[model samples]
Target: MSRWKPHVAINVRNLEQSVKFYQNLFGVEPVRVRRGYAKFDVELPPLNFALNEHPYSEVGALNHLGLQVSSTEEVLAAKRRLQEAGLATFDDMNTTCCYALQDKIWVTDPNGIRWEVFVVLDQEDDRVPDKQKILVEQPAVACCTACEKHSPLANE
Candidate 1:
């Protein structure tokens, strides 16, 4: 575990909803929860993420990005491990996020940034970032009502 692993933080529209979404997606419940912050000590595939509930209208651009795991069980196991570590964990069994079939967990650190640990079971090549057409969903959820609302991007 000496190798450094990158940790990312992002903002969420709703803490409770985001918490629930991650718990179900990753298959682990949060070990800690507060006003608008959550943390998960995710293991298995190895990811560090934090989630924060921000005013839907006040949210900003994504801070960083992430990669999905290979299995639903991996997501679930990660969730369980995180829960055991006394961190907040959320499991999304069969939900789609960021344009991929994912089982995931989410958390928010003290700084009010969001992070997600997920496994991609399937994908849709909708957003082509480069010459390689990899499946991807929109960057982040739209805060304004005028933005396109997708289930994965929406506040669960």
Candidate 2:
């Protein structure tokens, strides 16, 4: 069996300010920081959390939540289990999103909260030159049917 980490992603009005605040609160700097996103892999309370810069009016503070799996096999297995239980699942393979290349499968809980089982394939450097910023676009539509209809974050 692989380790499963609880993931929480939030929408922040300001990435830098939120990152600094969380660093102080958690007493550790983020392990990963990108242009508009940051991740804190905290061990004290056991959290795999991240923040993404977004206008508050578009989506409330909470973005989405997920489970970080160690391997693609785990993602597939989880997807299978969810599907077998009658939940709809959507898959995105080798997709570049959230500043990283990931393979993921998404599902929506009854309350319309989107959850994903994903494994990172590669992460882009945080300090990439400004010229490269223009080429980066917001991620395509998310993979959960319920979330897509109810949450603005699903299109981000």
Candidate 3:
């Protein structure tokens, strides 16, 4: 078993601009940069942070937060724990998302914040297509009924 790290994914208006900003803030360049995405594997603070370029009007600047586990088993264990606790979970196995092949589970907090538990299986050269990206982005609105029921914003 390996250590888990806090992962934050932010939606940016421009990839290049956001990348430069993060580079200055973190004082290190991104570990991976793709067509519409960039990742920073920061060690001092232990963060697996990423920037995703998207239309600001469609989705706000903040994307999703996550825990990057070392293995798929860890992800499944998290899914089971969440399910047992009566929380809704969405599982994506070997999905090519965010320019990586990953096994992940998504759970929304009572406040409607989405948390992803995932392990990277492999990396891909090309960026995720818009159609597929949309499906991944809207899991709360599209799948998580529990989130909607508890979300204050969902009502208004």
Alpha carbon lDDT of each predicted model: 0.56, 0.68, 0.66
Q: Judged by lDDT relative to the true structure, which candidate is superior, 1 or 3?
A: 3
TM-score for every candidate vs. truth? 0.42, 0.48, 0.45
**Which of the two candidates, 2 or 3, achieves a greater lDDT against the reference?**
2
lDDT of 1 by residue, 1-156 (tens): 796665645577778766765565445666678888887655633556677776555335654233367766766676776576566644455565556666666644323334455676777765556678664454465322111122233553
Q: Tens digit of lDDT per residue, candidate 2, span 46-152?
A: 78888887765554444556667788997888777767656677787777777677788776543334666789877766687866754434466653332354443
Q: How displaced is residue 36 in candidate 3, in Å? A: 38
As a TM-score, model 1 comes out at: 0.42
Residue 93 alpha-carbon offset, candidate 2, angstroms: 1.4
Q: Using alpha carbons, what is the TM-score of model 3?
A: 0.45
List per-candidate RMSD values in Å. Answer: 9.1, 12.8, 13.2
Give the number of the best model, judged by lDDT: 2
lDDT by residue (18-123, candidate 3, tens digit) is: 6765564444789999999999998845988888877654334334556688999878877776676566687777766665667887765432346677798876
Model 2: lDDT to the true structure: 0.68
| Regions more than 4 Å wrong, model 2 | 1-60, 127-156
- lDDT sort, best first: 2, 3, 1
